[model samples]
Target: MKHKIALITGSTSGIGLGIAEAFAAKGYNIIFNGLEENGSEIARKVAGQHQVDFLFSGANMLQPEALREMVAQGTEKFGSIDVLINNAGIQHVAAIEDFPEEKWNAIIGINLTAAFHLTKAVWPNMKAQKFGRIINIASAHGLFASEFKSAYVAAKHGIVGFTKTAALEGAPYNITANAICPGYVKTPLVEKQIADQAKAHNLPENEVVKKVILAKQAVKDFVPVSTIAELALFLASENATTLTGAALPVDGGWSAQ
Candidate 1:
């Protein structure tokens, strides 16, 4: 039997890479997309470790043409992309009045609009095959608001709404769409946010983490990337057909508050 393929963006490191390894271990071929220079090597390592077929693309999420070409290339190689994870994202933290116009545009473009383009690109093959898993990596801010994250918050909320719309439209086609909203995960992105939050709140990095970052999280620990990856696997499972349109939170009780 042919292996199902998963195309995950920004997967060279962090959460996306974790999910890639999990699916590869389950014998799924992978299409890895990221901007990291050693992404091909990283992809090769995971594929070798799991003995699965794989492809790597360093496509920029801000470029729709590049993203479309990526999907086309993966489809042509793997027959069909069975799972699509819209995981590429960038963030900037600043007050709305201080936020640069360029930053706003880039955030919205890469975070929210890229998901639309990729979903649209994969629609035909998924509709034809009648099996597709669209898992979006949204943030806790998708469900709640925070200061100095106007663009990121807006884009995440937009993606959550988009997930619901896709879920509704794909219900009849055996395609499922869902979003995973995570709290503070200590990835490079969040590391940068730690510094940004420190500056924004005029506190030390450690203080910012305790008083601002994890303040709303009932659990003081960071959400594990492995947990998020496992959830993504379940969402992509054949049994997950009925679990569509939900923005599931693995935020260490941050969502509970």
Candidate 2:
């Protein structure tokens, strides 16, 4: 009964999946959201393995009503949601002029605006409880820039700004908010980006990895999903009360450069 509930978006795959497993392993009941067709099964398997409670929602990030409904359902089932992780995101790589308007809109809608909607939906419950944690999964691009990724970078930068504002508003209510800026992780999304980058730069995929994909990171390795998950666990802990309103980088020294 003392266990808390955590609602994580995009939990069916990639970094979100890793984080969900971590939370469940810690006995945090999970509300998982993702667009993947098998998202429910994935959520169930993880929760079952960890012996934790869970609910799965196939809510598209662009749909505000659906996101709020998911929150309401989770709260109804769990009594209250203790944490929210805005981890669902999409990306596209193209020069500013060549970037499709529709692509830009979708990127901003899914990556940036969706976080706002989810946070707002969860705010009243957290405020009443006087305890909450909000974690935004931003990117290394949030701290810097890369050519041919205008929409993705812009949206991630927006996420960082949104995190700060949420932190300020949630301060009095003990609802801490922070953004995690990660270097590239070898997710399906990153794999797609690598392919796109290879084509864009007219280089072999291996060369693109060394020269373009990993060029910014001094460590020259993908950031581990587990590392990001661990930091999120820390931020969601009671000990992290004083750690709000910051964009902590987990970008393998990419941000240092």
Candidate 3:
């Protein structure tokens, strides 16, 4: 059998980076996606480390044409994209009354609509191969709400719904779509959230970390990016054929409670 190709969006940093590494570790030729000229550089480093073919395509995920072009270029380079990780997203924090229209549009456009566009763009290739693994990097916020996160909560909830529908459609074609909901990880985004929580609640950083964020989880620990990455690897594996349409939580038991 030929080596499978995996394309991971927003792979320059954070969860996307981790997922890329995980897929690479499993011997997948990686197609790294991010809106940076240096995206190919990052992919080169991973490819060198993993000894696999590497391809990169950068595009603003919000633009439909950019997304379509990116997918086209990626498939052309890699022959087929057997795995698609829709991990690009943005967040905005504000009460509904204070939410800016631009911010709301940006959040929804990148967080929710981009997934749909990418899915549509990649569906034909996946269907033709009758083999694909899609992993959407949703959030714990998808299943639950947080204060001052109106746009993020809404977009995440939309992601869960979209993942389900896409999974159902892809099922018959031997394609699997799933979402992974993670709790606070030590990424730059979550670090920003920690600082914002401190300022908003007028608490010390440590206090904000403990009481405001990790309080909901039974483990009360920040999730590691590797954990989510490992899950993505499993989902992409042929053994996980029965795992489609599942919203797996890597939340340190936050959603369980």
Candidate 4:
């Protein structure tokens, strides 16, 4: 039998990379898409360790055409994209009035629109095969709101809605769509937020992380990327067939509040 394939966007590092590693360990072939060029080594390493095929696409998620091409290349190489993980995203923190128009566009385009495009691109193949898993990496902001995060929050919320729509449409075809809302993973993105929050609040970085950045989280801890990866694997498994259209929160009680 042919090995299953997973196409994960923005999978060069952080949460995306974590998911890729988890899937590879499960013996799934992987197609990694991201703007970064440094993923070649990771691709080689994962493939070597798992003895599975790995491919990388330096596709800019901002462009819909590039995203379409990425999906096409993955399908062509692997014969099918059984799992789709939409994890590409960016962040910009500013009041709505101060938020640059370009920044809003970039965030919305990469974080929300790119997922739509990839899902659209892969829907037919998945529908035909009668088996597919669409896992979106949203955030805690998808469920709630925060200051200085209009665009990120909006984009994440939009993805949640989109995931539901996809789930409904895909239910008959045995394709599932779901979003993972994590509180705060200690990714480079959050690292930048630590610095920004420290500067903005005139607090030390350590204090900003504990007192400001994670102030709302009851656990006061960053959700591990591996934990999110485990969730992704579960969602992709047959055990989660009935769990579509869910916005499962891996947040440390952040969304509960």
Candidate 5:
């Protein structure tokens, strides 16, 4: 059997990179999309380690045309995209009243609208193939809320709704669409948040993480990128055919509250 192909956006680092590693380990050819800097080198390393084909595209998710071209290029290179992981995201911290217009637009563009564009770009091929996996990397904020995160919260909630819609549409075609909502993962994004929170709260970074960041989380621990990657693997597996339209939380019990 021919190996499957996975196209993961923002896969040069963080949660996206983690998911790419997981899929590559399972022998899926990878098409990584992110910044051009070091993207090819990362792809080469992953391909070498897993003995699977890898490609990289520096497609700016904020540009709809670029996103479409990315999907087109990946499909042309790998025949078809069996899995699409919408993992690209950006963040801005500000109250609703203070949120800059450009910042709001950019966050919505990258975090939410980009997923819509990529899924639309891939839908036809997925429908024809009668198989696809669409996984959106959402956040616990999608379910809950936090201060100084109006744009992030709104975008994440949008992702959950989008995942549900995609799931329903793809159900008959054996495609699954799901969202993974993680809470305070130990990624660059979260590290930046820790610092910002510390500054905003006038607390030390450790205090910001423990007292402020993890305060609402029952387990009071950061979710691991590896754990999220494992969940993505399961969602992409045949076993998850019946698991579409779901928002699964890996938030150290944060959403349980």
Candidate 6:
């Protein structure tokens, strides 16, 4: 991937940042996206660290036009995109009776529909170049349902189906599409979920984390960011061209059960 350009969405922090760092470590020029200004700064730093060209774009993925513009701007700067990681997503949990309609819309718009739009926008470019790697950061929730996380589960499941269909379509073009489904990863996003669980269960953070998040996993431990990052790196590499349409689970045996 040494002169190839990869675009990873929502890369300011968390799993997206991990994937970006992994790609940078492999000498791939990266186009980083986030709604925050800090994303660009981080891209500059990572590019410098890796000694590769880096591009940044700030766009709210919820808007279709913004998503298109983000891809356009990145391509204008980087020439062509060789890989795309659709890693931008949000999570909201609430009982069916109390779930906010707006929250549902926001979660689906960002987590599911945004990937669709971005992939559509990049499809022609990948086809034209006759090469692409598309990886979506789904979750264990995608394969298993959890109470009070209706929208998140639905969106992720949708992503898995979307990934398989995309993989089939891109196969003829030599483009590979896959999804990475992970369990509890200790990112700030999952940290927020732990905090919310603690408050809702009226338990200490540790107990809430142990009994709620890690208890379901066979290994019963939080997955490291490096695990997911390495998975993304493998999917982005030339060796993985044959490994498309897979919803690979990196959930410490959570989904295996």
lDDT string for model 3 (128-158, tens) is 9899888899999999998889999999999
Write out the backbone clash pairs for model 1.
Answer: none
lDDT, residue 179, candidate 5: 97
Poorest stretch of ten by lDDT in candidate 1? 248-257
What are the TM-scores, per candidate, against the unseen true structure? 0.99, 0.99, 0.96, 0.97, 0.98, 0.96
Q: Candidate 1, residues 74-93: lDDT per residue as tens digits? A: 99998899999999899999
* Prediction 4 TM-score vs. true: 0.97
Best by lDDT: 1
lDDT for each residue of candidate 2 in 209-235, tens digit (9 for 90 to 100) = 889999989998999999999999999
TM-score of 3: 0.96
lDDT, model 4: 0.92
Model 2 Cα shift for residue 249 (angstroms):
0.6
- The residue-level lDDT of candidate 5 at 44 comes to 88
How well is each residue in 1-257 modelled by candidate 5, as lDDT tens digits?
79999999999899999999999999999999888588989988988999999889999988999999988888999899999999999887777797899999999999999999999999999999999999999999899889999999999999999999999999999999999999888888888888877877789986888899889889978888999999999999889989999999988888777
lDDT string for model 6 (1-257, tens) is 33888889998898898888888988888888887757778989988998988888888888899889988987888888888899988876668788899999998999999999999999999999899988999999889998878999999999999999999999999999999999999887788888777766678997987798888899978889899999888898889989999999988899778
Clashes of each: 0, 0, 0, 0, 0, 0
Model 6 bad stretches (over 4 Å): none
Model 3 ranges off by over 4 Å: none
- What is the model-wide C-alpha lDDT for candidate 3? 0.88
Model 1's alpha-carbon lDDT is 0.95
The alpha-carbon lDDT assigned to residue 218 of candidate 1 equals 96
Please say which candidate is ahead in lDDT: 3 or 6.
Answer: 6
